[model samples]
Target chain A: MSWVNWILVICMYPFVLIMYFCLKNEGHDPKKRVYYGVSLSKEQAEDQIVTEIGNAYKKQMKRLLWISFLTSVPVLILPSFSIAFTYWCFWFLFVCFVFFWPFGIANKKLREVKLEKGWTTGEAQPRYTEIKEAAGIRKVKWYHFLGPVVISIACVVWAVLQPRDGREAMLIILAATFGGMTLMFAALAFWMDKEKTAIVSSDSNVNVNYARARKNMWKNFWVAFAWFNTLYTVGILFYQVQESEVTGMFWLLLGLYILFTVILLVWVIQKSKALEERYADKMDLKVEEGDDAHWLWGMLYCNPKDKHTMVNKRVGLGTTINLATPVGKGVAVFLILTLLSMPVLGIWLILDDFTPIQLKVEENCLVAKHVTEKYRVPFEDVREAQLLTKLPNIGRNYGTSMDNVKKGNYRLRDESISCEVLLNPENGLFIRLETEDEIYLFSGFDDTETRQVYEAMIK
Target chain B: MVIILQDGSEVPVFKQIRNQIVMGISDGRLQPGEKLPTVRALAEEIGINSMTVNKAYQLLKQEGYIMTDRRNGVRVRESFRMTPELPLESKEQLKQLVSEARVRGVSQEEFMALVEEYFSAGQRE
Candidate 1:
């Protein structure tokens, strides 16, 4: 019902739609001559069983698409963000597992059909690369890095110039962060330009042209991302300089940035597919290099024999690591753990937001509590305590900021920093307690309760 | 121009690279003074070790089949003479091949004719 809830729904819809469409078109794409990431000859791919299996997979994907999209509708009317946040986190893990379930099923079925029909592409086929295609002629020029490098340096300069208020420092660091991000894109673009492209066609010219087209597309994507970083960095700097309200502006910038990134990614994927199809279309659908044994369920690539750490993914748009390598295994474990911990993250968010802030006098100490994070100051140590009608213009720096609960380390607009805070801002009352070494702000569930705590603390 | 490498081949990767370039030259697909990819570039392209490619390039350079400089990277030789006398290694290998062909009922004249057919392309170029 709230604006924030609406934002959540809007954000989720596009993601699911894109995932659905991409997976829908994936595996059995005639252009790539791949059926469920399995390399099959034209005759084998066109078999009756293949069609029946592919259609069955399509039907299941359509059902999943509806389920994914329809589930998002319920979040629009969710009373609180905690429940919605929890749902979204779980939903992410669900989609990650469920969407791929269909792929895995389809891959297994197609691979079975491939074997049963005596259509096995050889396990150890040679990797063919044309010399002219490998020639590093169309390299990323040195000048292409100039703008992003300059921006990164400028960010550091801006950070150095800014006043060292905690929030102001964060804003300055953000400029540099954007600089780092932009530079990363520049580097990635450069590296990708140099990386070898997949050989799709027997014709060297066609293969060479396809590689060039794909490289150009990736280069454009990185360039776009670099510019995006600069633009968003400017917006953040503007907010910091103007000392403007963040609620609406933060959401607007963040939403637009996410939406822009998604659109760019989708365009890159679709364009790359088109280019491959255009060139590879001319080639006879002869089985090229096939490593069906290394690809687990046609999704996970686990080839130790591969010298390269990263390999072109058989099923998807991007590259995946060779999981048999040490670094690859570490990354895999980290990713799996991160996905598995989403429910725990949702729980943590709930506890941070829903737990009531307790402000009470115990043994002459002004004790503030929220879950395990607590701050206690002796009344004798409190140098000054002021009861303010309104909270300061502040933003979260390191802790939780919920709609009702604000329990965090925060920074004010005046370049000042609050060390500890546990307040419910809707009560419209706060106790700004200052000590020799620390600044603490506390408020209770209601204004009356906060007033009592303030009266007791000042006594 | 398409350099294909079998993953499970008994030949070392560097040998595979070296042999392919030699065959390409023999077939005239790769011409005299034609630019080859840099060691790093070729290694990355083929998903092999740079050291492996370097060894191949080193062998090619030692045999006067290719040349390398900082500016030009690596390239086929501007012109290299095809000597009539084969190296001891090649002669040994040729003897083995001839014996195999003789055992397989491919007469010496038939094998010589096959050899002539392969050499004729480069000779014409």
Candidate 2:
């Protein structure tokens, strides 16, 4: 047997074991039960049933994430292995990873908490009751894996049986596989959209409004698609340059892809901007006197404002907590780091270096250091606070950041002071109270304000 | 005006709706004859099952807090007033308990004496 077959067999072993474990652990596990509003001894049987269900969910998620990740590994390594092997593994991995990542993480987190706290604990109670009810069982749909498995098997067989020694056959097979996958994805997305509409009655005005928002979002998907295409076109250009054997046909396709991408991106941006402006105007019109409308557009855009506000009230807390902005800043930093690291490590193999970093704010201190990054700051020495504000400038030099700054359009407003006090533990920090205007800077952080605004957040 | 659902609360959705409407009435939020959203419309707006809203409306109607007419939709009951009275069954039960107390060598005067003593004790702090 060839090395390809050996590798395939090794990969298949884990897949079979994972599937079996998931299937065996399909129902609730008694060990993970939660006893609430009753004596443990009296509710032991019911608790057992609940625990079993929770454990099954945990196992199912573990299986899904592991299988998805394993599948993705080969696919991600495909481009590098393409010359040595007939199939592309990277694309397969990419699709599986994206499809399962969110569900996997949510399930894993739930399971971890359940195991740590045990079944009888209130905190370990299954929080996904609604989701489970909606999804029915915590098992993968047979149809989900059917298309990919068939394609994978067909590729393996074709690679082994095909008589051609040239790369053309391999290229054709890869293209065909990708094309088929794309068609399947499009069909799936269409079906999901249809299902959403079906679940909510069409006559309901709220449903109608939600549907309109969804439609608007669907239109916005083109923005993401355009960006992807633009990036893909750039990758193809790089490939053509590196491998100088490209024909006229490749150039034609590349040119078409770039044109379509640019046009769609411009259209998406213009439409999105128009929609946003209109939305803001509508919201402004709806505001009434004495209404406790604490939400602004930015808050609504980033988080589900209604849900968060209700959650805050339920916890007997005010909606004054602004953890969203800090979380958003960390996410922005992550994205920047990932984008920066792309060239150094080939995008496909970048996951090997993936590590999570946490930045925490304590009662008296704030820390903005990553787990992987070399820089570390412990709030103690951070004595200075500055606010860098910028204004938009139109006309002569529209595109340059330097020109915009040089035009004195950017000025630091020193009228009101705001500052953050950092603490040791880094989960809860303090802000010195100054004035209403100064507190506006901390509005995004959690509607709270300080006497001196930090320079780090000004931009 | 819209009432938002409290997802994290232990309070049932129907109870939340009922309480909000009651508060609205007491605070003059809903005028005497102002038509409220139909059960279906309210349910849709709140993103909850229509049955939940219907249940709240049914409770409100039974309590004389709101009145629903086929032609006019639902509205705050005109000339509604809250009255404090013990239920017939509860009053009967209380009488039985007092009779039992009398059987145990406790007279009406003695019971009154105990009540006064308990009240005075409660007020002392």
Candidate 3:
């Protein structure tokens, strides 16, 4: 396995736990009016059957969490990074499916019991908003996005003006990273401002204050995100330019960044939940007319009657698209397609890693090939071909870097560029073939095969 | 200004909007010259069709309850034209109401008492 595999595996186990807790947090909220994604009255929520269902769902998720942990054990021993990476992808999806499956089941059961006991919250959509609150300027203004946008733009410009070498690809990625995150935050701010401020009670003051507080919290979050990304960009770029792994500094900064990000996310989520509790603490469903029926699986919001495309999520921190409108349907289709493509991408990566690298001598020329990557250098242009047991700090500029395969353009720390079509770096053998245009690093499937190919080329 | 919409109510969405706004005015919750949300904004806020809110606004404008213009958007009328007689619509409603009260065994004295209490429901100065 490679460093990428190790990083992903480390990140994933904690993620499973995080997802579990997020679902657990969704249990009972006056703002949401649901238990396990099922709407119920205060009396029904306390019913023996309802309590039993909630516990059962929890137990099932715990079992799935343990199972997910166990399955990852096999991934550690997987032969290559490709296998491990593929297993991790599918395993993550499996954990997600199994985790949500119990919630969906519990939701279904609770809904059934609600119907049988006549304890429905009520059949209400986004059907109410006070007049004054509707017109209240309780939104984060557009200028709230200005700070982040300006910082990210400066970062992108800085990246662009950096000296152009063969590292153009690397710089472009840096620019894209900063620019993309800025755009995302800006869009999020805009989308959120456009959403209707929910009327939690008859009091417009409470509603207005609640809306303003939430908007301010998110505004702070986006601003913090900008600072975080800026620091990361500066740190990474400094290291790249120096052509040295300030490994200790890089790791420390990365660790702190991740820590801060997690804390910020958790803070926002808790603050939002608290804000709901503070404002609508006395909110109680008086009739069977609840919003549970409008949500699918207690997660997705779908109300055909709601003209707005974006609606507040029933469970999580962010908003979800309504599945009733044309835009909502389009978003749903896109998400479904994306979910379906995960496994396909995993399979494709595995195939790419397993594809053998071939070095052939033909017609006074040498060709090193792996998958779709082919590098041919005429004997006349080939200045040198040297076999080595180790490579330099060959960082990828724009290429594939799987455990078994490394192909396409790469660069030495602080150096220009090289084209590599190498397989099985674990074999501890490689060939440095230099041509007029660029350097080529290559190898065969094994030491013996590579040595044979090198001898033939020399002859 | 809180209005709980009954989607299953027989009242059309536009009528519900109009009724609520009119009630708000009479209840003094809506002040004269107070700006109202645009047709699109109110419709989106209430999660209904924009045209529904437009129709309500058009009705309100025609009845001189509200006004609309390019610069002002929509707002409650500063003052309404005072007439000595009740509108035909109110007359019809009053006719139905009195007939119901008579059938329900309400004496003239009791009916007039109720009328006095409601007529003086001027909670706002």
Best by lDDT: 1
RMSD in Å for all candidates: 3.7, 30.2, 4.2
lDDT of 2 at B94: 75
Error of 1 at B52 (Å): 2.8
Displacement of the residue A394 alpha carbon in candidate 2, Å: 54
Best by DockQ: 1
- Candidate 2, residue A86: Cα displacement in angstroms equals 26
Candidate 2: list runs displaced more than 4 Å.
A1-169, A176-259, A276-281, A285-341, A344-459, B6-14, B18-125
- lDDT per residue for candidate 1 within A237-287, as digits (tens), equals 767566455675665776778788878878888886776566655754343
- Residue clash pairs of candidate 3: A121-A288, A121-A289, A121-A290, A122-A288, A122-A289, A122-A290, A123-A289, A123-A290
Q: How would you encode candidate 2's per-residue C-alpha lDDT over A198-228 as one tens digit per residue?
A: 1122122333343355444543453345234
- Per-prediction TM-score, chain B alone: 0.91, 0.65, 0.87
Q: Relative to the unseen true structure, what is the C-alpha lDDT of residue A350 in candidate 1, on a scale of 0 to 100?
A: 82
DockQ ranking from best to worst? 1, 3, 2
For candidate 2, what is the lDDT? Answer: 0.39
DockQ, computed on Cα atoms, for candidate 1: 0.53
